[model samples]
Target: MTLTIRPAVPGDEAEILRLVQALADYEREPDAVKATAESLSATLFGEPARVWAHLAELDGKAVGLALWFLTYSTWTGKPTLYLEDLFVAESARGSGAGLALFRALAEAARGLGCGRIDWAVLDWNEKAKGFYSHIGAKPTTGWEAWRLEGEALDAL
Candidate 1:
């Protein structure tokens, strides 16, 4: 039952992609994912990395991915750990892999003096909502997420 959470290295490209694809499938947008290992590697391992990730291994097998980056909180005047993606394989969901991954992220935030950690969950994913609630995360009721992308983003 030993679970290990470690920073992703270059050799873990394939595992990262596999876990990301699995997450996409669970989110019901399997084909929406266009991230390649090359893109991930460049973002995570390239000089002046803009993002980072943690890989969770259970008994020597890859089972989860937690990709994140630092974000500033203007009000708090500190940084926050923004968890971009968190995915645990279906076979490992209840085995505490997800919990371990999140705990690791919290530790990363603490180490960096971050004010808090933030993430988004699809509104339809009740399972994720339950897990997040179980971890003591509250929904930000008044704030709605907005996006500027595609043609709108290009036009601006």
Candidate 2:
């Protein structure tokens, strides 16, 4: 399969959401995603462009994506590219779609002069861990991932 990766455009919102929902399913949380095409378009193509995504296509159909944004690292005093989500459809997993997405992301990071690229992987996803290892991505030790959501987020 030929994998092609490119930045998402205004018209690709629906395709992007499909990949996101597919991701939620693969992670065993089929109903966890709440994102909609309207929201995705607004966020991805808004005036400020807060976030960016690169979509991967195989045989002329959208199959995967890397959704990310820029983050400033205090210690490094430079920008870092933080990948919020990375997913390739099950049917397209072994076709180098994931690697193509990461390579596209790396190119974006390099274009933006980002110092590092980071993202989290589920602890139980051994396949994902192996893939990360194959790409030379190491998990940061001594730091626990934390988040405030739902009631706690509303409380704040």
Candidate 3:
């Protein structure tokens, strides 16, 4: 039950990819994950824009990860922490790993003077929705999430 959360390093790429794919599978969108170790290494550690990650370890084994990046909230006029993905291994669920990951993100937001921390969950994932509610996160019912991917994404 003891968990340790820390920023990821280049050596953690494979583990991070595993966790990310697991998350995609859980969301019923297995094909959505296109990241490879080489690409992940380059994007996360390379130039242009840097993506960051935090890994959660239980009993010294990686059990979960949170991939995130910084974003600006024009309305708030401050930076925000955008949690791109959060995943806990099936065996690690209910062991407080998820909450620990969330707290770690919140702590980072606080340290950076971030105006907010934002993420989205599938509507059908009742368990996840309930957990977020239990943690006092309200769903933004007024907003609809939109995305452009594949050809459309590339066209732009």
Write down the TM-score for model 2. 0.96
Residue pairs with clashing backbones, model 1: none
lDDT values, one for every candidate: 0.92, 0.92, 0.90
Q: Give candidate 1's error at residue 102 in angstroms.
A: 1.1
TM-score of 3: 0.93
Clashing pairs in 2: none
Return the lDDT, model 3, position 93. 91
Clashes of each: 0, 0, 0
How far residue 120's Cα lies from its native spot in candidate 2, in Å, is: 0.4
**Which 10 consecutive residues of model 2 have the lowest summed lDDT?**
1-10
Error of 1 at 39 (Å): 0.5
Mark the 10 consecutive residues where model 3 has the least summed lDDT: 43-52
Q: What's the CA error at residue 99 for candidate 3, in Å?
A: 0.8
In terms of TM-score, which candidate is stronger, 2 or 3? 2
Model 1 global lDDT (CA atoms, 0 to 1): 0.92
Over 4 Å off, model 2: none
> What tens-digit string does per-residue lDDT give for candidate 1 at 40-116?
88988999888999999989899999999999999999999999999998888899999999999999999999999
